[model samples]
Target: MINNKKYLVSFMLLVASVFTSNGQDDMDKFVSNLLQKMTLEEKLGQINLSSGNTGAVLGGGGEGQLIAIKKGEIGATGGSSFESIKKIQDAAMESRLKIPVLIGLDVIHGYKTIFPIPLALSCSWDTDLIERSAQIAAKEASASGVCWTYSPMVDIARDPRWGRVSEGSGEDPWWGSQVAKAMVRGYQGGDLSKNNTIMACVKHFALYGASEAGRDYNTVDMSHLSMFNGYMEPYKAAFDEGAGSAMSSFNLVDGIPATGNKWLMTDVLRDRWGFDGFVVTDYTSINEMAYHGLGDLKTVSALALKAGIDMDMQGLGFIGTLKESLDDGLVSMEQIDQACRRVLEAKFKLGLFEDPYRYLDENRLKNEVLTDENLEAARELAARSMVLLKNENNILPLNKKGKIAVVGPLAEATGDLLGAWVMYRNRDIVPSIVEGIKSVGGDDVEVLSAIGANLTNEPNLRKSLSSPFAMFMGEKMVVDERSLEVLIDEAIAVSADADVIVAVLGESTAMSGEASSRADISIPESQRNLLKVLLKTGKPVVLVLLNGRPLTIEWESENVPAILEAWAPGTAGGNAIADVLFGGYNPSGKLTMTFPRSVGQIPIYYNHQNTGRPFDENNKFTSKYLDISNEPVYPFGYGLSYTSFEYSDVEINKSKLNGNDKLIAKVTLTNTGDRAGEEVVQLYISDPVASISRPVKELKNYKKIMLQPGEKKEIVFEITPDDLKFYNSELIYDWEPGEFSIQIGTNSQDVKTASFVWEK
Candidate 1:
C-alpha cells in the first residue's frame, strides 16, 4: 500500500514538472516572436522606464512622456496614479504593436492599507505574517492599477545610521534571506498572471545597505569573501524565490557604480546565481555614472546596457542616448534586443499582452483598497511588530479603568505613524494614538491627551524637510511658535489628574529613510524635556516609540517604567498600540537591529566578528569603550512578553557531526510566569575555528511557539554541516572541521549553550 501511494505521488510530481516546463516553453516562444518584429527604436523603448508626472515626480521631460508613450518610446512608468497610468496605457495601445506599459510603484510596506515599517515587521519573527502583509499590499496595489512593486528591499542592514535600513530586513543574512523569500512569495503569489498578484523587485542589487559610514549612496569596498559570506544572501534568496525584477544600487561595487558594473550585474546575479529576472537602475542611476567619472551620458548608457541592466529607470539615458551609442558601435543591436526582450518577457509573464487592464477593475479598486479586512490585518501586524523593550513590574497591560494621559507630539498625529516609502494617499485613514486609546478604552478608561511639544523645535529644518513630500497627502511636521513653557504647562495640566501616562515620541515621518541619516539616533531634545517633566508627575510612564530605525534610548531604559518600540506602525498603528497596552495582545516582536546605549557605538550589531582583543569590561587595555560598555542597550532578538519563559540547557543527540548528517539539538522550554504568551526560540551556532575569522554567533534557525501558563514543551532543531558553512579567504563556500557551540535561547546575547565537534 505504501509503495502504491509513493508511485501515485511520483506520477503527480512528474505531471506538475511537465506542466511547468510547457509553460516556460510557451513563454519563450511568445517572447521570441515578439522580439523579432520589434524595430531598433521600439526595442530601445522596451528597455526605457520613465516616471509619469504624478506621484513623487523625480525626472525631467515629463511634458513629452505621453507623446513618448504614443510613439512606443516608453515601456514602463512608475509613481503615477491609476487614472494617469491608464492614460499612458491608452497611448501605448495607439502604437503600431499596441504593447501595454508595465505599471510600477514603491509599494514597500503597504499600499493604501499601510502596515508597520519593514524593520518593525521583521521584529515579528513571523514570515507568515510578513507574507500576508505583502499579499495584501499586492492586492491593493494591483486593484489600483499597479502591476509591479519596487519592494522586498532585501538588503541586509546592520547599521541603524543607514536611513534606508527601515526598508530592509535586519542584520543577519540568514534572517534577511528568509524575509526576502517570504516577501517575494507574497508579492508574486502562486502565479504572476493573476490580477491580485504583482511582480516583486528585489532592490539595491549589490550592497546598498553596507554604505560607508552608514550613509546612503556611499561607496562600498569589501572582499569577495565578505560579500558572499554576509551581504549577498538576501538578494540571492530573493532570486531563488523567483523575484521578477531587480534594481541596481546607487552605490559603487569594486569602485565602479553598480549600474555599470558588468561583473556584479551579469557575472554574479545572472551567471552565478541563475537569476533570470530583468534588472532596472535606481532613479537616474545610469545618468549618475557620469558623476562617478565613468564616462559621458552616452558612454554610461552603453556601459549600463552591457552590464545586464535591462531597464533604465527614470534615467532617460537609454531612451535619449542608446540610439546614438548604437550608431557609434558602442552598443550593438543584439545587446539592445536582449535587454528589450527581458523587459517584454516580464510584461508577457504578467499577462499584459492578453489583458492590459487586468489590474484596472474599478469595482476592485472601490471594494478592495483599505477595506476593513485589510485594516484589521494591518492592526494585527502592527501589534505583532511592536517590541516590548522594557516592562518593569508589568507597568503595561495597564488597567483599562485608570485615567490614562496620552502625551507627546505623536499622540494625536496620524500622518507620521506611517513610515517612509508608504502610500501617501492613506493618511486620513490612520487613527491617532489618542483615538486608539479612546476606541479601545471604551468608557472604562478616561483617556486624556495632549501634544506636549512639536515633533521638532527647529522650524527651518522642519519646513525644509516638509517641502519635498508636501505633494503627498499627509500632515508634515508643524513647528509651534508657542514657548516651550506653554506646551509643557498644557501637557502637565492634562496629565496632573491622570493615573498613568503613555508618552508617544520619536522621529517624525521625515526622519530615518533614504537620505535622512542621523549621527545621533535618539529621542529629540524637545520631547526629552517633556518626558523628564512627565516623570516628575509621580505617574508610571510608558514610552511608546515611533521611529523607523533602532534608537539609542539608554536614559529611557533606565528611567521609564515601560517602553515599546512601535516603529511607524502605519495606518492601524494607534489601535494596535492600544490593544497591546490593554492586554488585548501580548507582544511577540523582537528587535531585528541592535539598540546601542550611545551614538559612539554607531555600527553595533549582534552577529559581529570578535576582534583580536575582545572587549573586557575589567581591562582598560582591551577592546572596551572608554565611556560606555561594549554591549548594546538591547541586543538583537530581545523582547519581552506579559508572560515569562525559562529554557533548559541545550541537549545534543551527539557530540560529533559528519557530512550530510543531521544533529538534533533539543531544549525544554517552560512558561514559568503567570500569563500565557508566545516566545521566539532562536538558534545560534558559533564557529570558534574557521578558515577565516567568523562572527562570535550566527543565527541559523528560529521558531515562534505559544504555550499555556505553566505548560512545558520540548523544542528540537536539526543542525547539519551546511549551516556551519561560510566563504573562506579564497571565496570558497565550505565548512572546516572545528569545535562549534550550539546556543538555544530567547535572544542572541542570553543563551544556553552546548559544544559540539564537526568532522570533515
Candidate 2:
C-alpha cells in the first residue's frame, strides 16, 4: 500500500511538471510571433511603462497618455482610476496590434479595504494572515481593472529612520523571506490567469533599505557577502515564489544607480537567482541616472537596457531615446527584442491576449470591492497587527462599561489612520476611534472624546510637509486655531470625570513613508505634553500609537499604564483598537523592528555582529553607551498578551550530529494565565565559531500557536546543517562545523539557550 501511494504521488508530480512545461512553451511561441510583427519603434513602445495618473509617485500623465496608448506607444500604465483604466484599455484595442495595456498600482498593504501597514502586519508573525491580506488586496485591485501590483516590497530594513521601512517586513532576513514568499503566493496565487489574481512585482530590486544614514534615495555601500547573507534573501525568496515582475529602486548600488546596475539586475537577479520576471524602473529612475552622472538621457537609456532593465517606468527614456541608441550601436536590436518579449510574455501569462477586459468586469467591481467580508477581515487583521508594548499591572482589557475618555488629534481622524501608499479609498466610511468605542461598547459605555492637541505645533512645517496627494484629493491641511494650552485644559477637564483615558496620538498621515524620514521618531511635543498632563489627572492612560515606523517612546513606557502600537491600522483601525481595549481580542502581534530608547541609537537592531570587546556592564572599557543603556526600549519580536505564558528549558535530542543528520529541539510551553491567547515561538541559531564574524544570533524559524487557559503543548523544531549556514568572507555560503547555540523564546533578547555540536 505504501509503494502504491508513493507511485501515485510520483505520477501526479510528473503530470503537473508536463502541464507547466507545455504552458511555458505556448507562452514563448505566442510572444515570439508577436515580437516578429513589431517595428523597432513598436518594440521600444512595448517596453515603455507610462503613468495614467499623477498621484503616489511622480510621473507624467494626462491626455497625452491616452494618445500614446492609441498609437501603441505605451505598453503599461499605473496609478489610474477604474474609469481611466477602461478608457486606456479602449485606446489599446484601437491600436494596430490591439495589445492590452497592463494596469499596475502600488497595492502595498491593501487596496480600498485597507489593512494595517506592512510593518504592523509583520508583527503578527502569521504568514497565513499576511498572505490572506495580500489575496484580498489582489482581488480588490484586479476588480478595479488593475492587472499588476508593485508590491511585496521585501527589502529587509533594520533602520527605522528610513521612512519606507513601513512598507517591508522587519529586520531579520529569514522573517522577511517568509513574508515575501507568502505575499507572492497571496497576490499571484497558483495562477495569474485568474481574474481575481494580479501579477506581483517584488520591488526595489537591490538594497534600498540600507540607505546611508537611513535617508531616502541615498547611496548604498555593502560587501557582496553582506548582500547575500544579510539583505538579499527576501528579494530572492519573492522571485523564487514566482513573482512576475521587479522594480529597480531610486537608490544607487555599488556607486551606480540601481536602474543601471548590471551586476545587481542581471548577474545577481537573473544569473545567480534565476529570476525570469521583467524588470521595471522606479518612477523615472532611468532619466535620473543622468543626474547620477551616468550620461545624457539617451546614453543612460541605453545603459539601462544593457543592464537588463526590461521596462522604463514613466521616464520616456526608452520610448524617446532607445531608437536613437539602437541606431548608434549603443543598444542592439536583440536587446530591445528580449526586453519587449518579457513584457508581452507577462501579459500573455495574465491571459490578456484572450480577453483584455477580463479584469475590468463591472460586476466584479460592484460586488467584490470593499465588500462587508473584506472590511471584517481588515478589522481582524488590524487587531492582530497591534503590538501591546506595555501593559503595566495589566491595565488593558478595560471594562466595556466605563467612562472612557478618548482624546488626541487622531481620536476623530478618518484619513490619517489609513497610513501611506493608500491611493484609493473611501475615507467617508472609515470610523473614528471614538465612534468605534461607542459602537463596540454599546449603550452601557459613555465615551467622552476631545482633540487634545494638533498633530504638530508648527503649522508651516505641516503645510510644507503636506503630500501632493492632499492636493489631488482636494483636501487641505486643516490646522486647529485653538492654543495648545486651551486644548490641554479642555482635555484635562474632559478626562477628570472619566474612569480611564485612551490617548490616540502619533504621526499624521504624511509622516513615515517614501521621502518622509524624520530625525526624531517619537510622539510630537504637543501630544506628549497632553499625555503628561493626562497622567497627572490620576487616571490610567492607554497610549495608542497610530504611526508607520517604530517610535522611541521611552518616557511613555516608564509613565503610561498601558501602550499599544497600532501602526496606522487601516480603514477598520478604530474598530480593531476598540475590540482589543474591551477584551474582545488579545493582541498577539510582536515588534518586527527594534525601538531604540533615543535618536542616538540610529541603526539599532537585534541581530548584529558582536565586537571584539562586547558590552559588559562590569567593564568600563567595553563597547557601551555612556549616557543610555545599550538595550533598546523594545526589542524585536517583543509583544505582551493579556495572558501570560511560561516556557520550559530547551531539550535537545542529540548533543552531537554528523553530516545530513537532523537534530530535534523541543520546548514545552504552558499558558500560565487565566485567559486564552496566542504566542509566537521564535527559534534562533547562533554560530559561536565561523569562518567570519556572525551576528550574535539569527532568527531561523518561528511558529504562532494558540492555547486555552492552563493548556500546555510541546513545540518541536528540526535543525540541520542547512540551518547553520552563512556566507563567509569569500561570499561562499556554507556551514562550518562548530558549536551552535539553540535559542527558544518569545523575543530575541529573552530566550532559553541550549547547545549542540555538528560535524561534516
Candidate 3:
C-alpha cells in the first residue's frame, strides 16, 4: 500500500507538469517551472481574493478557503492568521506548483502597538518617526503571518467632512508625497524576502479622496491639472520607492472609474509615471461598477483587464470569467500572462517559493507579536497625536489632586478605543481611558463617571449592514433625552462636589471610516445638551473630543474653557489621553486636517487658491461671505504647543537668484513663554503674480522644534528652483521665473513676511 501511494504521488507530479508563465530571469524560470506543473485550473486560481466572514478583523477574511484551494479554485485570500495561512499553503502544495497562497491584511497604524490613526501621525510632520511606526506595524503583522497590507493611502483631501481623511497624509502633495514614501519604506522595509515586513499597497490609486460631497465612495471630479499637481504626487512617490502593489480607488478619476480608466491605469499609472506593479480593485469595486453604470460583470471585468487591473478583489470578476474573457478576444493571453507573472513575482519576492510556510513560525508569533515595547511605543504615539484645542485659565494639565467627573459615551468605554481596522489587536489587554486614568490618578484623585449619552439614538441606518452605523444617521446622535438627562443630572450632581469636569465626547467606532462621514460634523446633540447642562454647573468643563474626523465646534470652541482634540487614539487611547490630561506629559499634538467652524466650509483648507476676489478684512465685496468669515475656524497645520514661540522678522540669504541657483531662508524662533514646548515653524511661499492662479499661501517647509523656556534658535531652510515649481497648463513641472513672497510664522495665516526673486 505504501509503494502504491508513492507511485500514485509520482503519477500526480507528472500530471502537474503541463500548462502555463515569466518577470526577472531567475524569477521567471522559477515561475515558469511552477506554472508548468500547475493545471489550467490552478493557473487560473491565482487571481481571486476571498475573506472569511467572521468579521473579527477590520476588513475581514474569507471562509471555506481550504476547500477552494484544494479544488484549485482560488489563488489568494485577503486576510488570515499564520496558522490559517499555513493551512492554505498546505492546500496549495496539493496542487502541481506547490505555489504558496498570498495573505493580505489591513495593517494600518501599528499592528499590535496601535499608534495614533494616520490623520494624527500627519500632524507630527516627522518623516523618520512615521517610517519607524510602519516598521513596528510590519514587525508585529509579519509575526502573525500577514504578507501584504492595504495601506499608505496617499489621497490629498481638502474636505474635513470626509471621515477617511484621518487615514491619509494631509492635503499638500509635497508633504503627502514625502510621508507616502516613508510609509512605503516602513511597510516593505529593505527586503520582503525576509520575515519582518510585508508588501505595501499604495492605495485609492487615482483620486478616491476627492469624493463628491465628502461622502465615502462618492463620485469624484477634478481637472487633469488637479490630478497631476494636487493628488497624484504621493502615489507616484510610493511607486518610485518600489511599492509592490496598487489598490485602485473606489471612485472615478475625471470621467472614468479608477479601475476601468485606461488613461489613468495605463497612461498615468503605467506609461506616464511608470508604475510596474499589479493593480487590484478595492473590495467588490468591479461588481459595484453597476452602481457607477459601467455595465455587467463580463463587460466591466473585460474593461478592467484592458484598462490594466491585474487582480479583482472580492469582486468575483476575475475567477472563471477572466479566463473566458481572455479566450473571446476581450482580453488576450498576454494580459493574463502579464497579470499572472506579476502575482507570481510578488509571491517569489515574499520568499514563499523558498519556503511557503515561512510566516507560520510559532515562536515569532508568541514572542514578537504585541510585546510590551510596542505598547509603550503606541502610548507615546497616542500622546503625541492629542492636540490641546483649548486651555482657558490654565484649566488643563489637570491636577491629580482635584475631584474629577469623567462622563461621556467614550469615557469609560473600554471596547471602542481599539477602533475599526484593528483586526490584529489583543482586544482585552488595551487599557481603557477610565482604566488608564485610574492607573495613574489612583485614590488621590476622586474619579466619578457617567454615560451621559449613547453614541447615537438612530435605530436604522443600513439596517441590514451594521447597527453601530444607525446612531450617526441624524442630529440626534444619542436619542434618549430623559436617559441622557438623568445621567447628565447625576454627572452635574457629582461635578457640584468635584473640582473639574472631564467631559469626554465623540463618535462611536462606526461613525468614521468607509461609509462613515457626517454632513454635520459636530458633537452629537445628545452630548451637546449634556455638555450645556454640565457647563451650567459652574465647574471647570474640559472637553475631550474623541472623533475620527475634524468636527465643526464653533460654540464649544468659544464656550468651553479647555478642549482636547484626540482623533480616536487607538488601543491604549484612554491611558494616552489620561497621560496628557494630568500633566504626566505635555500635549504637543497638532491638527493634520482642518477643523471647520461650520459645515458650510466643507472644503476649507490652508492652501486654497487666491480667488479673483480674495477675502480681505478690509474688502466688503471681494470674495467675502454674506455673514460668515471666509477664514476657517481652525486652520490646517494648526495646533497649539504647550509653550508659546514668538516669530522674529523673516531673513533671506539673497533677495534675488539667477537660473538654477538656490536660496536660503532663515527665521529666529524664541521660546518666549514659561514652559518647555514644541513648535512647528512654518514656511509658506506666495506667488503675487503668476501666469495661472496660485494659492494665497503654500506650506513649503516646516520644522518641529523643541526648546527650553528662554531658548532661541535660528532655523534655516534651503530652497532650490525645484521648491518654486508648479504644474502649468502645458503640464510641464517647473518653476516660472518670478518674484516670490516668503512668510514665516506660527501658523498659515499668522506670519511675518519677506520677498525673493528668481530672475529671468
Which regions of candidate 3 fall more than 4 Å away from where they truly are? 1-24, 32-40, 51-63, 458-482, 617-620
Rank candidates by TM-score, best first. 2, 1, 3
Q: What TM-score against the true fold does each predicted structure earn?
A: 0.95, 0.95, 0.93
Worst 10 residues of 1 by lDDT: 1-10
Arranged by lDDT, best first: 2, 1, 3
Q: Which stretches in model 2 have alpha-carbon errors above 4 Å? A: 1-22, 51-62, 467-476
Global lDDT scores for all candidate models: 0.86, 0.86, 0.77
- The residue pairs found clashing in candidate 1 are none
Write the residue-wise lDDT of candidate 3 on 273-326 in tens digits. 888777888998888777889898988988888898887887777774777787
Expressed as tens digits, the lDDT of each residue in 294-356 for candidate 1 is: 989889999999988899988788988988998899988888988988998898789776567
How many residue pairs clash (N, CA or C atoms closer than 3 angstroms) in each of the candidate models, in the order given?
A: 0, 0, 9
